[model samples]
Target: MNIDISKEDFELAPGESVLIHTNEFIKVPNTLSACIYERYSVKSLGLMISPAHYMNPGYKGNIGLLAVNHSTVPIKLIPGIKICQLALFELTSEPLRPYEKQGGKYMDAKSASISKLHLDAEIQEFLKSKGVQKASDDMAKELGEYLMGHIRASAKRLADILRAEEESQKNG
Candidate 1:
């Protein structure tokens, strides 16, 4: 789900990973492409931005990030925070098919837009051939819920153990 950070800050729980986006709209020139990187300052806060980092030439959208909170505590993420860095590359030549031309679903997509993998040209073709059209969301959502449950449970257990240790130390 896309978090609208415009109104208020978002709190990311420990062991949680979320898709975030830079609120800024960007336009990449046909001659250039871009890559996204986690800023060191943000990384130091135990938030890691995973890859799929290549922003193709002609991509016009807000930058998206897969941010994971690795620390034991929750992290408050504010809007307009400098969470990631963008590095542009001047391509020797533009792709035969640019991001928009090649059916990249993310072109001009909003920040944290749900995956458009289903909209990929090849995938659409295969679905059409099979006369089958199904959202991959059901399985993906179930898996995400299951994994988040497991993570929350594990974090709770760890916190309990730490609290017990602290109590024991104080009593001793």
Candidate 2:
């Protein structure tokens, strides 16, 4: 279904997430500019927002961004909270392909999420063997590193996509 953000806001429990507004309105006179950063700019402030946050041309809704908690500790998110700030720009012209139609994996994500990176069966087996109840310190540390690796790889892939998109817009 299609999503839109009104005046209502939402609060997120430790691991909870919801779609929020980028506080942008793209109209004929003004274009919305969204910066896909490595972290949330409001609550986490200094923390990084991760992997491929974007806004499409002609988009006019509560911008959906996946804001998965990356901390080991619990965190709270409230509605209308400036999870991020959208910078507005005046594009010389409307882009050829809108953001939603760019055909990326995260076209309409509305909340925080886990890595979509592929993991091997062997690693899954190893992690499973560690078990929720029996994970050792070393295992925990290793898993954290593994997660980081996935994020890094995903970030690189996103960068490639953004670069290509930028080029496409420029060429057209």
Highest lDDT model number: 1
Q: What value of lDDT does candidate 1 attain over all alpha carbons? A: 0.80
lDDT of 1 by residue, 46-106 (tens): 9898754788889998777788999999998887677777898998986898778976768
lDDT of 2 at 79: 40
Clashes of 2: 9
Worst 10 residues of 1 by lDDT: 132-141
> In model 2, where is the ten-residue run with the lowest total lDDT?
1-10
CA lDDT, candidate 1, residue 146: 88
Look at candidate 1 and tell me the lDDT of residue 141: 69
Angstrom error at residue 1, model 1: 4.7
Identify the runs in model 2 with alpha carbons over 4 angstroms from their true place: 1-33, 36-52, 96-172
